[model samples]
Target: MATTTISTTNIIQMTVNDNDYNSHFEGNLLDISADPEAYYRVVLFGYITPIFFLITLAANILIVLVLSRPTMRSPTNLVLLSMAVADLLTLIFPVPWYFYMYTLGYYKFLLYPALSCNLYHVMSEILPTFFHTASIWCTLLLACQRYVYICHPTLAKVWCTNQRVTRTILAIFLLASVHQLLRIMPTIMDDNSIIMNTNNESMINNEPQKACRQVIAKWTTSIENLYFGTYFVFRIVFVHIGPCFLLVIFNVLLYNALKRAEKTRNKLLNKQQSTEQRNGSSGWNKQQQQQQQSDDHQQQRKANRGRDANSTTVMLIVVVTVFLIVEIPLAVATAIHVTENMFTVDIVSDRFLSMTIIFSNFFIIISYPLNFAIYCGMSRAFRETFQQMFLKNLFTIRLTARSSSLNPFISTATTTSTTTNTTTTTTTLSSSNTATATTLTRMKNISSASSKGHY
Candidate 1:
């Protein structure tokens, strides 16, 4: 084989052509290398994405800590905890490779030359999608769990146990992993090495040398086409479209349930008020007191249940709503990308597709961290637990340190005051004793004088 000098652009084109895959890979590469809009995307991936990743990592970690607490453990919170873990891993595994590829503008070679290309492929492509799919399924599970709890309280008891939820989460992640493997298994890393020119100055001859080797995927054409064709359709139906559709239905059902519950609660309150007013007008008696107390107790219990259901329903609604807002566009874009090749199709410009994918990905990353905010804002229990786990301990430590620092002065003042009081008390007691003794002696002397006189 002739030693062909492949530039960065040619390497990307050759890789795609070699795989014969229908992807936006070529368009994205071209956009980043030649398009004007790619500067913003570079800035976003380089600077903004890392910031979001850190925030998301920290937030999800805190969420995991809070939700995993013994007190915070519930079926719903367990789902949230699983989701946080998924989100955390989704960013963690791919970010280093992504940073190296995009931030450093080194898309041609592996960051570590010694690592196997297959492992790099999994890290760069497979794991992020796998974990993100897990997160998506977890979100769907959360919505369904809440819907069952608020809408069908009886069924929720049987269906939404902690053990059952745990099993379901495991199933979700297992299925997601299997699905990603299916997507990735058809393509293997190419065994033949391709020379990549670094375009750097040579120390000896000042000539560009083939110093780097690039890893590419080898695809059996018929198998690759059939597999991806099926995989894309499956992904569209199960991964993107199915979840979004179910979430919408669940949201609608939940919203209606919430409204009905609110109206029923209002009616109960009105009836309770009317009954109390009538009893007050009639008269106050022993029987009336007992009846009123019973009514008050019953109504209070109902009110509390209603309030809890309403708040939780509202919070889940916000969560699903945010997910839908971010996911729907990405789903549509993904569908289009699967349907049309940007290189061949003129309906959507390559630049537009590139920008769309970039923006969609950015928003998806942004969405991961927003859940922490939603939980804090809407769920009082989550907020309280978070404070107790993180903030409260920090504050307590600061207060303890302050008190410890001040303890010496405080002890000194207390000791000095105590010593003065002790000395003063002793002196007073001594003076009283002395006076009594003197008085007793004088009385004795007088008695003696009187006796002598009489004799």
Candidate 2:
């Protein structure tokens, strides 16, 4: 067997760059994740998060802009606007940093050691709790506002006016700010503090890096103890669970009120019909003279029931349902985890715990971005206005549109048709015509733009 030798030129070109690089690889390349679950988590979240962030940003912007219109200026909408603001804050403030954390901050925190103590941790600790709490409370306020509107009309007109709504929003912001400040005050220390407390203990065990590591305030341990012991439970029970229950109650009451109103309308119509029959043809003129007033009243009631009760009810219900579905899981999980951790229970596997945290985070991320879709699905005015703004090519923006028009969207023109069809002995006129007929047909998207409805 003949062994072929390499050419001198090829050998010279292939000469290895003097490399400790071979030794470096043999030592260890960085492993992003050892666990299968964590690897999957990184891939899953890292892929979809950027898309969600973009959607949330644009949707929230559109919501705010559309709600800025004069027609949308109502108490319920005001509350909804606040909720959108909170959700938008959630998406914008900490979300990008969080995405970074998911992708590389995990490793960076490990490498730098001090990165954990930086503004990133401070924000991660604060914004999620603060904005989520604010958002939940905003949702609860919207449900309550709707309850007032649907269940009590006179009181709603008086109490749930735009001024009152504005005041309530201000109050909510003040309360949320104070509550969140108090909640986060203990968890964070001033990393920017120039005066180092030599008396204070170090953040990590036998670590010299002091930059972003947790500098213990003497009270931090005590605060953490109290938080883990009592506050978390209080939060889960009263703060989280209370809102969920209240939302269901308000929505149920609104539903009942709608059913009652509908029943009342039917009873009135039946009574009117029976009275007409009893009066007979002799009394028809007098009854009809009275019928005009009755019809007017019925039409007014129908309008109120349609505009006031139905679309807004659906909107509120959807918001609350979405909130509950997305947030309740995290709330319940947090409660359980905190309780277990407080009690030093070790029944939870490490994998389970990791998955839980990831999922809870994932749920909220998925939740906040969907308000625009919900509004679009439920509110025709919103959808049409959005169409005017975004889908201008598909739908014309009417220059004459008033802010208060019921459905200023579709242009309608009835087309009359006639054609002559001749048989051997007979001539017949036959015709058929069609358009998309959006305005002439009833819109199925249960919303304010639909002109005729009762609850």
Candidate 3:
């Protein structure tokens, strides 16, 4: 049996029949045919990337489907839809390309020239940046919209318009593309290629001249470092630090607003309850009791409204938190790799270290697709559309089960209440049911109003 061993110094090398073959690593791709150990690494990625690509592609497609529905096509949903599109691009272009390179022993379409390498790097960087930046900005917009809706309901209608949201998304994409283009130029242009031979000697005759162009300069180091440093600073701000700060502030403001609303609701409920108690006098108090009950019903409606607002805030926080947790470490790692002076093939060639970084890239790509599930779990509108679009049968099954369970209880209660209740009691029961129905109808109307805008 043949054996392969990987270590810090020889992670990119393999010994076969008393001879060693080393893998040559340049910018975005690796030459692994010479190394048995390196082949294992590529094989690992080859097996896994296809799975991630398909899964993520499916998830993002589902997101688009849910967002495309006329009822779900709010400004918020539109932003999410764009995010899904960007994420799909992120996965579709980059991961498949990576898998191709890994499985085939070289990058296919991207190895045309050193210039082509730059183009591919720019593309690879741009797609990730576009999707990630768009997601963060969209989430921020949604948070602000939510803040406006809860903190200033009347002004929310005027401020958070569909036009403004569309413009914001456009601006985010344009700005991200520009920034990514500028930041990446220095890294790509610093190509310095040095040819080496099969005997580990400088060989001019047998070498592919294009692959010889590598990026190495003492000056290139400073320029590249500056470029990566700038990128790192921006990434930390835009992706991690900025979003976290906004989330904290938004949650604080939302909590305060909800607290105030809850206090008002509770006070009103207490007042209505007191009024009912004071008016209590059997038949004489029945008229007064009905009026107080109406006020209590209004108070309950307000309380429910506040609860819904809180629920939305909580959901946004969860989604943002998940995104930040998954992507920030990868950002930090890339930052270190690009900016730090200590980065060399020697440090990077440690088998464990290389594997860790390689695994991080997988998650980074996979994270884009997972956002749909996050949105579904977090957003009520998304969940409803998703259920309607895909889980309709499951919903019907659950609805039937609920109906069956409730039928016997509802019938028994109706019979008991009819037998025991007098005219006044019947009137109160009627009013209670009317209030409940009114609340449900109002909710349905709001949902329908939003639904009408989707097409």
How well does model 1 score by local distance difference test? 0.75
lDDT of each: 0.75, 0.62, 0.62
Residue lDDT tens for model 2, 1-455? 11111111100111111232121111111112233365555655666666787888888888998888897787877888888888877767665554775665462322233344345654655666677677888888888888887777799889998898899888777776766676655543222212221222322333332232133243555455775456577677756878888888887887787788778877877887776567675556876758766886877687666765587687778778877887676666676677677888876675676677678677777777678888888888788878776788444445345422754433322111111223421321122224334432444454555545654
Report the Cα lDDT for residue 340, model 1: 83
Question: lDDT by residue for model 3 over 239-263, one digit each (tens)?
Answer: 6567757866776676687688779
lDDT of 2: 0.62
Q: What's each prediction's TM-score?
A: 0.79, 0.67, 0.63
For candidate 1, list the clashing residue pairs, or say none: none
Worst 10 residues of 1 by lDDT: 23-32
TM-score, cand. 1 vs. native? 0.79
Candidate order (TM-score):
1, 2, 3
Top-lDDT structure, candidate number: 1
**Root-mean-square deviation per candidate:** 11.0, 17.5, 14.6
What order do you get sorting by lDDT, best first?
1, 2, 3
**Candidate 2 versus the native: TM-score?**
0.67
